[model samples]
Target: MGGCVSVSSRSTCSSRSNGERISPSCLWIDMFRRKRSRRTFSDHVTTLQHLSSIPSRIFTNGRSSSACIFTQQGRKGINQDAMIVWEDFMAEDVTFCGVFDGHGPYGHLVARKVRDTLPLKLSSFFDSFGSKQNGSGANCCNGNMKSDVADPVKETSTEDRVESLWREAFLKSYKAMDKELRSHPNLDCFCSGSTAVTVIKQGSNLFMGNIGDSRAILGSKDSNDSMVAIQLTVDLKPDLPREAERIKRCKGRVFALQDEPEVQRVWLPFDDAPGLAMARAFGDFCLKEYGVISIPEFSHRVLSDQDKFVVLASDGVWDVLSNEEVVEIVSSAPTRSSAARILVESAAREWKAKYPTSKMDDCAVVCLFLDGKMDSESDYEEQGFSSATLQSNHSGNVVESDDGQNSEPCLQRNFTVRSSEENDQYRRVPIDADVEDAENGGTEDQNWSGLEGVTRVNSLVQLPRFSEERPRP
Candidate 1:
């Protein structure tokens, strides 16, 4: 009973004074296993903690001291619109805001992916450009390795340097985003694409990068002390003289349908399919070779006290509401948090009154208030409005899905039809010939025959013969 118990050839446990003995080897092994297990559990918990902290910084629908964002699905299929406001985006003083409107099938996914990734790419490029500028006074431009301004003395003013840095970052990030979309394993972006209007606010300076029809407008008080809408980014439509010329030069057709005489769209040379309403977008590789570029139009604005707020919205809201009207609606909101929701509801109402038959397009809005001050109740009264007037009846339409994603409660529909200035442009066409006939002024009996099935269409009528050669930069 007093003998040592050998648990292993090399180790043993001495007997206690009573009668039993225990193996120290076994106890040591147990303690080591417990420590290793605890370490593994601690690592998992830290990973989960890091993940949980992320959603707080990236907000989809919420209000901050300087910003508020909201989005609603249209009658069209899924909500293809995605939005984000990343507070403290890269630094404590900087914030990133963006709204992406997806088009064609899988447009929602494309929009979401772009919303999540484009900002990261921009941040990376911005940092890289900063490092390069700090180390060697070199600048990147249009894939060129040499600096555009070779003379060091020409690089005058901090504003000019900042603008140059942001411009290069915007261009490189957009190009990288498009390339990533083309090769993405989970995404089929050959026909689907998204319109992006992104803004980075650092101190008093605002850096914007925009492509496609989605718009960013600034609300500022004019000399008259009245609010005015200053459009920051141009709506890059196919009908723009330069845009149309480029498309035509690339053998891409730019024309308006007989039914919608005003809505000029970009079409393929061989087929009457995938009529894109905008001149630029991310993805839509089918049209990339046809002069549809992803290069964003970059702009920088220094904010003043008179600059009230900035509204970045999808074309859906812009299509139905005028810029002035949107400004008025936002300014009239009872609270800053309710501004975006009210604007979207107003757009929805206008859609019903303006185009009774056409499906409402998805609307996403981000309102970034320049000043942190909230409007007093007296401000609403001065505008001759009440809080009740700005409230939206369809506010509850946006519900959290089982996947923890916010989506409108609606049955899945076919492809989407992009409409602008009261003209409908089909992004993807249905397989039905009757629908084609209807679109081409078919018999009166065929009117609205395939309109219900109208959702986002494949941007291609038929897949064109792709060349084996590498794509141009």
Candidate 2:
């Protein structure tokens, strides 16, 4: 016979300047005392964000989380469809969790390119979010008590600032990626881009964002204190109702190409390119020009004490494993990183189960386990210089030197080099009248495209003269 179990607790109260009493909510979090599975909280605890910030600790017991990624190259034969990327960032203020899945030939290239630049972009966004949200502070005090105003205010203020930074970081990084891809000639062939689903963990807060089909799920400890699965980021596919409406606006059509329960394939340019299923992605210049919008759906949420861990996977992994099944395997593992490996392995196992003779597609999984420090032990020791730990002065620039005397402004750059043979092969003519004879030395189209990879990325070389706004440190 099942019966209801009620539990409650009392805490001290305080008063605020508004003369109202405040108290922390008495959360009736259920404890799973038995072996039963917990309820899924994907529908609840909405809103999540992702950003580049300080690194988070990897392990608690002096053991670092090991990452494992396997690429099978698939049964479809030549691994033509590439869609897997996994990056683990261990930092001070937060942990960078990212998974970028690409389609077609250039998906991997675009994913790799964006992955390296995300943190710098995030740093730029955090500065913006922090400025907007933390001004004059947020309201911290609430109901019935009046004396403990300062504590609540401090707590709320801190949380707001942290959450804001995380959210803005993601939005900015995504926008930057979109902008960067626009002018890149190397990305010309990358008409099909990638889906990125990432999360940054800071203390008890989790900031996550998703673009395209890749996903992130939170496995929370249920009422019985047993772990349960919760989806943090929504999958941005044309199959979803809201997403469908968005697609319609952009003159796109989505069709379910496969008959899988959990897996749904949607496409645009429906009559011809039915295989490009994901509605939103980075690059895919052809889609952009054809009015196929690729706006990402982002969310930001705080993980409660009940949260067990998070699982991030590509469509390759999710194609074979259901959310519940994935959660079970992941939650059973001793650590999050292990759970990530197990999830990928489970996908491979399922592929083997289905097609004993066929090879499987590339698969990747990353798990983030969130639990308090055991015995107040730190998960990671302070290591090399972290971008998050650096404090900026009143001028809003990070003073690299301890004495604030010799710090150089950080510049984001990418450089490429080519071999002499390729350079000679793609030799181009100079068009400047000042170099007349030399200008006509080569063919009309010398095809410097060969020198493309070796060229520096997006150098807006024409310098615009501007008045200096602030003094350098």
Highest TM-score model number: 1
Per-residue CA lDDT of model 1 for 1-473, tens digit only, reads 00111122222232334744433212112211211122254663454345314643443555555676778878767777887787766665578999998877667778877877787778767776665444322212212334222232332233466677788999999999999899989787877899999999875668899988788889999999999988777677775666778899999999866655455678888888678878899998888888899998787776777889999998888776778888999998877767987898898898787667677878899998876554555653353334422223244444433222444423242344444543453323332222222123432121111122232332423344467999789
- The TM-score between candidate 2 and the true structure equals 0.57
Candidate 1 stretches with Cα past 4 Å from truth are: 1-52, 135-156, 373-473
- The all-Cα superposition gives candidate 2 an RMSD in Å to the true structure of 19.6
Q: Give the TM-score of candidate 1.
A: 0.70
44-163: candidate 2 lDDT, tens digit per residue = 112011221213322111213323222233333222222122223323334666666655444445655555455545644654444454323223321323444335555454445454
Candidate number of the best lDDT: 1
Error of 1 at 85 (Å): 0.5
TM-score to native of every candidate shown: 0.70, 0.57
